[model samples]
Target: MFLAQSFVFSLLAITGLALPSNEGVKHNNMARSTKYAPKEPPLTTPWTDKVGTKPWPEYPRPLLQRSDWKNLNGIWKYQNASDLNAVDSPPFGKDLAQEVLIPSCIESGLSGIQTDWGLYSWFSTSFDVSSEWKNDKVLLNFGAVDYEATVFVNGQKAGFHRGGYYRFALDVTEHVKFDQSNELLVFVHDPTDDGDYVIPIGKQTLRPSHIFYTPCSGIWQSVWLEAAPTNYITQLDLDANMDGQVNVTVHSSANGTSAQAKVTVHKDGKTVATHEGPTNKPFQFTVSSPKLWSPDSPNLYNVTVSLDKDEVESYIGFRTISRGVIDGVERPLLNGEFIFMFGTLDQGYWPDGLYTPPNHEAMVYDLKVLKDLGFNMVRKHIKVETDLFYRACDEIGLLVIQDMPSLRPLQSVLPDAKQQAEFARQLDVLVNQFKSYPSIAIWVIYNEGWGQITDTYPEFELTDRVRQLDPTRLVDSTTGWVDHGAGDFSDNHHYANPQCGTPFYSTASSPYDPSRIGFQGEFGGIGNNVSIEHLWNNQAAIDTINQTYEIDTTIEAWNYRSHLLLGELEDQIRLFACSGGVWTQTTDVEGEVNGLITYDRRVSRVDEKQWKADIQALYDAAAARSSNSTRDSL
Candidate 1:
């Protein structure tokens, strides 16, 4: 009965459904803690119950997926210790004091243990190896761990990784006890603003208030295991040219042995191209009558790669993205056609799940809602999300502008040598990890002046490095404040008063150097404190809700403010000639009520139809201006 009701509810959600008022549901004392037995569950999404048995059970890496893999995300024994030296000793035999949900962070509500225990936490679990994986190398893969993570297998150290935002794998072939249960343990340490190191920690604050959010710590993503042959396909690089051909590179490692690879591309369940190449070289093949990928039609071609005894399934889209001058005005072009890039600032935060969503459907829901609202692009602000997010964007045909997570303490000077090196290493890893996704069009190296504050502007060098690494995509050297004469776009930020709407948009100031494209990186932060009557009757939300909203005048003021905000948006896009613009945010984060949707994602403050119309008008106007077409014709 519940499943049937849930299905009905989803169907109703597509058009729009009025939410039940704040009543009936019981509110519990749900304070965040690190204790074994906390008061109660924190705020939960509608998909909470669906996170049963094996949460995030799907293959962690979608671009390179295999059927033979194990999900280790259900339950794991966890122990929190203040002593930093707890990682020296192996935790294979010790009994942990508590059990926490894997993949979700300790600070999140869905993790079972809603806590802020950021550093020196140990987690352990045991799993048996299948008979099919006996002769192959058993590989342990971690989707991501905050800050630093060290792993141990059966009382022996397997490997360690430094970054908190990228995936890393280790080959545990020799250490595994075949066919028997083997103990696995991992220790994580995150200095989330508590330490003196300069690491990239996008928007996380020790004392969170206003724009800063709760610091996520320790195992915030998925962990799993897979079996691969000694001679296997390690990585894939895909590039589709406008000339009806794609360059496919299959990276294989045979442990000093030779291997041959066969690549095949399929469209509409029919084979379109095939090539056989040496394991070390890339193969090029042509697709006859190739269908291009765009927002209107996100056509994807399935790829099958076979290397000796190993086989993997992947997908790619053929599209071209570039910046060009059309009618004397420069704009972002898609498939040799001028396009106006309008997008939202997505922080990738949730009330229940910090880094991870409640379920896969929830991730898709966010993108779907935005797409339905007539958005063609999204600027993933600061943090790097899981592979599922990029995949969802790809399938939904939403262009993505990925930001390199910024460092903490808000420095006005350049980072030290060691920290700079660390940032570069992580940046390289970030590009290599998600570069295969065709949805990702822009790589933002530094945001505002978070870490690169030197007069020499180190961001220029960083942007050059990124361009060299992934020349296929455009690079935005800095988003808001500084531009060191590098990258493809010159960006600016604006927040003008609603009372001065037309004047503000008409005469807005930005650094528009003729050599690069122009972009309004961020603008318009119109606050609308949600009415308590509209929220769920749960104490989980009591802390994040604004007490000032209790006043009736505040509600009226915000409603009028919403009208003014819309006027401001209309004027900005109608008046400005920038290539694109990114609004402040998509959903309301804690303490910031400026999002189009509420933090819970249950309520949209603005009228949905009007909002979509306004956004579409902006796109059409920009397209007309670039193509030198009259607005009436558009």
Candidate 2:
């Protein structure tokens, strides 16, 4: 949630990751007609292709919801023109260069307009708002529009937003015309590799590498409107303390309007406990035998918050995370017990959809896979996802170590005197938005010291800023060794890793030195693809099996190097009395053939039963260690 520049400079190369839209370019403007380069396969959808048809049609915002909203998602007229003034006319009913899908990045295959980049491109759509919406209120919401966006509602200007990764809403209720069809226009300018602080740029490149795929831009999420009373639920923050007491923090435009939270604890169809309270300024309640939420069991209680009059309804969870000394070593305790979190660094990328998932069902599919694979946690490395993803994590019981995407500073050395404060501001909004979810276990400050190079002691690794924003959650100052004596855990990332860092205590006795609990923040990348798993869709799928497509044929008869992949990974996942793990990734991206599943989400490369057994063994080992430590103390 914040930046720390505690340590001195370190020399390391960390390129070759996921790519956003706005691919390779001096300028992100591909107005000229250039032949489309080799692309992936077309997305296979149940729906028949037609005009005015785009996937992801639900009202995007679940928090501030409205029913009387028109979807501006269908087909819209467009031109690959550089400037906005070229076509003076509304640009409607005019011939278009090619139909591009909404909620998908322009660079993606789903969006017909595949260009290297578009610093200047316009998205226009028109819809009629019901008179009901006119009477109450209207808000135009873009689940997220990449880079920069400007809105024009019904010939009148509305608002604009930057930051391609986060979501935003504009109250166009006033600017929108009442009776007539409203015109909504968006102009986006996204520079991917051109790192900026306002938006933390991920592995977005004009040309994608190792883990990075193509960059996504211009509304990769859902967009809709909401109508609310003059006084409505502004925000809800769920705070679960170690006392087993849960506090609900509600913020609204109007006060004196009472609020109560109805909570129900559940496990295997048995109602454990239920509580309801006047959720006025952090109401507190306790769960009996509080079926603590964890990766293994993920026991969760349902919470429904209603206004004084039972007007608006919102849902949250009751869970707490804290760091405490267990036996002699310190470890992260969930709810009350210590459980080691181990999982992949989910990049949240799709083959055809790129930035956006084909649909919500597809989005859920990814999480469900993680569950099936016996993963209790996921480290969202260097990127953020829609709240819906977090919501699913809450309901499904996946612990998240969310990393705020880093804004690449001008210099890679110390903290930027100018950008430091700005990064802090963005970090504040990020923490406030996702703090309530029960699945989020830790807040990661930096990934391998991305922006600030802190290779030595007392590193100013942005942990100070992160702590100020969210001291509740344990902070990992820097993923790798930019140790500045800041973070709660000494995080590290090792690719194709054979060994893990020494235990926190061993840092002094051993060569590693004094450190907190060590985690395999990143490790375990073994290139093992399934036969015809479809890493990239291509003409080869239709044509004869040429020897050139050797990878697929090789994988068809692929015997997983189980001993090498897991024997080594198991050893790594157990190192330094490892408290948690953020495995490389869940699925394979463009070039990085190091995912458990392919991009299409079809095949499982590894043996499920065998993998689970290995993971379970790790847990058993930890349990045994905890027991041994207890015995030795006596």
Candidate 3:
């Protein structure tokens, strides 16, 4: 009934008519047509709010924010291609008859068009370019578009992007009409598990029965426009060294090769350091007394960069991450100190928005809960999130283990060159997109054996590529199952307990052996209870290895069961002597109730206070070991 009313309100607003009072009339799902209103199961989060004209109005890129940008994320005209071939043609004059919400996946309930099977989706909208931006170049940015996207601005092809995860931008200055309104049309094609392409699908299958959930297709992220000077700063990379030095690399674009970059670092709004260098070269700077970034003290310094006629603001946190021997155990070190990463596998799924969060506050709430439960890290499983999500992790002081979304067909033994190259290219793009975020401490190139199925895994090649791209952070070539002796650490996945003990603490047998630091990439998938009211599929089998309480639905019973499950994690961390341990999940995804929190974010299965205390005790023990290790070395 709630969904039906929302649809009615949407239709009235789209047709430029006011909604009537909601008094006695009741509207049912049977009356609404799927063409106008999709028939999806009604599920909502507490963060659900009336999406006004401009949804997600916050600056999409918080780290590099500007005041001159305009948000293009409100209602957009959309049309699903009746014929797949129609997508190849430009959608300049074609009429988009249906209305859809921007930035939300079409399969999600919040999108207002919940049909997910469409291979080609077209979006068109008119936006005005401010006259103040006449002297600048107009840049159109898409936070993300799934699978493949071809963009057209005012009847001209502007740009094309292949990967669905990372952010991309196109200079629309040549395609835009400065004084008049500009028409923007984007065509997105996503072959999600349909066998048309072998790409990273990441827990999305067409037949989402047990472990997998629904597929997110087309424009699942924000789209916006920014006006920048013709000569602008394109990218910035910052690496903090353990010796109190930071390497700053800046890339800039200009009409000629004479542009130089001037950078200034500010601490507490006071200038601390400054450097001027060529746009193509890196600039090194040092501080007298550096304040490192950690869960305890997340100190960040603001920076401003200027090149020719452009200037942008950015911030960085000084920290170093590596793997080393500590207390006779191989462990991950942060800021020259060994730290055990106790985290959860965050799938980044929502009950309402599927891929996109309902609002910025919704994203913040997830991080807050993780921190409240005494977690120091989050292994972002398989999926690459928006820049805002990474920013939230940085601000909230949560370390990240970013995983490359797995390409499907795990059992296959042969490697395809085209798929392999595409995967590598996308991995490079992912690193370039998120390298500026200090929260990301490790990168997982492949998950289990999904994409790395060959006898000799090619992850060594991918791992080498990632290192060449960004050598500051550590890399786990493959998370679990079938190690081909590459990357910085060895990973194991087990249920309830990790069996690969002690060997990882010793020296490597061969110099080429990459399995040194042991990490429990995935474990402890314990399901407590399934809330029938919030179940996406009640009949679906619970997707977990260990079921704590098969039939317990009461809060008391679920809490008791979850307490025991979380307690097991503390023992597993020490018993395995792991550098890091990521729990099965942070929240329950569809058809899977193994998360510590419920699917709707309404209930935590365990007592928060007790869970925090237990996790904190483990953290205390790990710190003590690190201190002892330092003393022994001295």
Candidate 4:
């Protein structure tokens, strides 16, 4: 059911997904409110009775996994006031006008409370801690809050957090009523894009169109509670090697003092391994030629941890990620071989959820869909995701290119003297937040030129900050057009075509100090839009066709259309066998309409054969010298 022009495009796309993306977009309205739009639907809906209660309550963090956390997710009282200084009264009193949904932002429809003015919104909830956790410390957990947030337990401010992307905790043992229902109130303010904070907001707009959507305002992540002993583990950065030995540096609340840690590994629900040691010593364990973790085979070993006086749980994968000379060019070596990170520029957005995913399943669906279609990594463009998203990637074996949400006004990239100092403060905060996540192998500083101005100087400053934060993982100083001549990777963003800017790939500073790795951070955005079933339909937006597409560029048709794109992508990918390319993205976002798959994930544009062939070729070329000899020979 493909029309002539679409068919022609299909043929061309089959030859390759070669349309370049580097062409600078006409600076226009799209960028203004892109992140403001509600994104895609969820695999599960809390609104519907078709399914029972959403099962996400099972402790969101499966890595530093916990079995005894309380999910404060469902219902809550929310109201948006003109400003923080509002009518004097607790929410749900006669003073408030309406009720809002929990977990969904006030700007979202599902939230049951969408506000016009970016005002001060308040959320209040109450729950009783289980009697079993009485002796244990009660900790309030917020997966994320938009910009600035102050948390109160029993009407008393326990603690406050500023960054909206990373999770934060408050020891509410003193504030919560153990025997009675304890009330929790959270106040959030997100000056999304408009406000001058260093959040990495990509394509968020006040009015959505093309590549821009709605901005995620207010509390966009999850809220919950957990029970921990006086001493609990904070972060666990796990690393492994092909020989089957794993290493971990457990960051706990108590530092400088000698500590003991008991690590247990699990499969399914049963414990298959265990490791106990002193924090002063490296916690080591050996598995016999274990199933290595990969995008396809996301094998994870559960870890139940017991710190000297604390008992916590987490997980680990016995896989090794390294960088060495492959065919004379330096690239990432996974399990001792080069595995080209064919990925997407995932500006995690939703038509319905904005920054907050409509459902937990929606959160994990993109990675599963992309992995199914053939992709190993996702450059989490700009915005940072919840712990669940990272948990999904870690468990499912999807590599992450985690970018710190950039600051706004698009001028923060070249921070002024005043802002430059603030930049360090913010960067330091960001690094301390997610540095421990193992899947985050690369830390991207600025994306394109949005916030960047003073070319390499700002970049080097930023790069130096990241290296100072965590020395293990690699750093991509900037993801797009600018090069800092610092960081761990010579990264670049080229649209419509694939290239690592080979000229900069080899010298001591060629790949940004020659000692670093070279990566195609962004490229391959040749878009052939299928009008039908699009999240943002041009016809619908202009108030036109609701009729069925005669051309039917539906998933089936588009998948058929993929043959051309895949072949082209394959050819481009093959050109740099040794050097790797991170494809434009895993899923479609807004109007910059080129994706191997659709935004909703219901449609796949790349034909399966062509997609696999191109991917296999890239994998073969890059991983020809890996432990998986078959992959190398392919």
Instruction: Report the number of clashing residue pairs per model.
Output: 0, 38, 0, 62
What TM-score does candidate 3 get on C-alpha atoms? Answer: 0.89
Deviation of model 3 at 104, angstroms: 0.7
TM-score of each: 0.87, 0.79, 0.89, 0.79
Model 3 lDDT-worst window of ten: 505-514
Show the lowest summed lDDT stretch of 10 residues, model 1.
Answer: 498-507
* 1-634: candidate 2 lDDT, tens digit per residue: 0012101100010133333333222222334322222123333322112212556776564543444566766555334555445324334333334446676777765565545565567676677777776555576777777777767776665776766767776767787677686767666777666533334666666555454456777667777766655545566666665456766666654667655555554445565556665544666667555555566555555545545333343444555677765666667777656777878878887766676676778788878888887788888877788878887888788888888777553334344556555555666667877777778878876666556544443235456666665666777766665555567776656544433445332231222323476566776665554345464533322132221112333433332443354465456444444676666668776665667776667766767777788677767656654653432110
Residue 413's C-alpha lDDT in candidate 1? 40
Tens-digit lDDT track of model 1 for 477-572: 887765667788867766633211122232233346655776778776666666664343334334555532222235456546545655555565
- Candidate 3, pairs of clashing residues: none
Global lDDT scores for all candidate models: 0.74, 0.60, 0.75, 0.61
Index of the highest-lDDT prediction? 3
Task: Report the C-alpha displacement of residue 90, candidate 3, in angstroms.
Answer: 2.7
lDDT of 3 by residue, 512-600 (tens): 13237767777666666654766553244344322332434676775675566556555645665656678877888876777788788
- After superposition, which runs of candidate 1 have C-alpha atoms over 4 Å from their true positions? 1-42, 255-258, 412-414, 496-510, 533-576, 628-634
Name the regions of candidate 3 deviating beyond 4 angstroms.
1-41, 255-258, 413-415, 500-515, 537-569, 572-576, 630-634
